[model samples]
Target: MRGLRKVVTVVDEVLRDVGRPVPVPVRRVAVAAVVRNPWAGRGFVTDLQPEVEALAPELARLLTGRLIETLGGVERIEAFGKAAVVGLDGEIEHGGALIHTPYFGNVLRELTEGTSIIVFSDDRLPAGEPLTVPLWHKTAAATRSHYQTVQIRVPDAPRPDELVVIAGAASGPRPHARIGDRRTDPVVRLADLEKLENAR
Candidate 1:
């Protein structure tokens, strides 16, 4: 929180799809924090661990807290993900350094009671560009219904010396998701594939 310049939160609700009413609305939330990139303008520092250790957890806590609050409650969140956008002057690795480590991701998982590895995206960009964070089932990685994304953009952020770190959560799957879970799909061996190809 110390290096933060601003925080933005956005929420989206889908009540219908394809001109049909949804029995239950789908809610998606994204929280983005603009923070000073510790390694910015430092001329290629060799070690990034110290700054990451000092800053990553706090940033994760702050963003994840906002996400949980916006979604009404922790239990309401069934899918989650994270993302980071580094300013133009900073290396893409600077953004990756913050969100890719366990320091940041574990906080999100612990807070939401998620067991699966959290999905993520990272990039380097100038201000006002949109980024999409991918989300998946909190406890099941192959639950295709819960596979989704939330787009976020800060009007003025990551001004060549900052990073836009993001966290996303969804209350449920896409509206009227009919595709079954990945686990339900039948497994095909290499031999079976060859047979099918020959038949074709």
Candidate 2:
């Protein structure tokens, strides 16, 4: 199927005036597309690989370019993520088809040189709804400041026969990150039930 009916982009900049020793600022952006759902309302299709292979790279290229443009350049980006929202007529896997493969991440990793995995969100939604795309530091998952989300809302998209696919980027981590990464830091770990409750 020839995919990509439309593309949408959103960017947000946040600033903290007094949350830390010095003021903090951040930039986050997302690029999403509304495309014809190749499998929607169709009977069981055993092989979805061809469709996936055909679409993943193109979507990755388009989104990554937009992300670079939004952030001024690829060098300015520190975190990355992706997401998709399928139309009512489509299956959840339709959304997954677009964002789950390394074919997609390969583009982001090559361009951004992001070592850590890309976070994601995929769900079925109607037109004019919000899709929250999660973000994380490229190589430093333990860095608290890089965890973020890009929320995109298309006024009239992902119509019954469509899917909303997305990619995202961030200039830095959270403004005031007191917590550490659960993946690397020992402090951010499992705690005894008694100690956890006592602190609360």
Q: Over the stretch 139-159, how does candidate 2's per-residue lDDT look in tens digits?
A: 887677777788999989989
- What is candidate 2's local distance difference test score? 0.83
Score each candidate by Cα lDDT. 0.93, 0.83
Task: Estimate the TM-score of every prediction.
Answer: 0.95, 0.88
Please tell me which predicted candidate would have the highest TM-score against the true structure: 1
Give the lDDT of residue 159 in candidate 2: 95
In terms of lDDT, the poorest run of 10 residues in model 2 is 15-24
Please give, for residues 1-200, the per-residue lDDT of candidate 1 as tens digits: 67899999989999989999988898999999999999988999889999999999998899889988998889999999999999999998899889989999998899998999999999988899999999999999889999999999998988999999999999999888887777888887999999999999
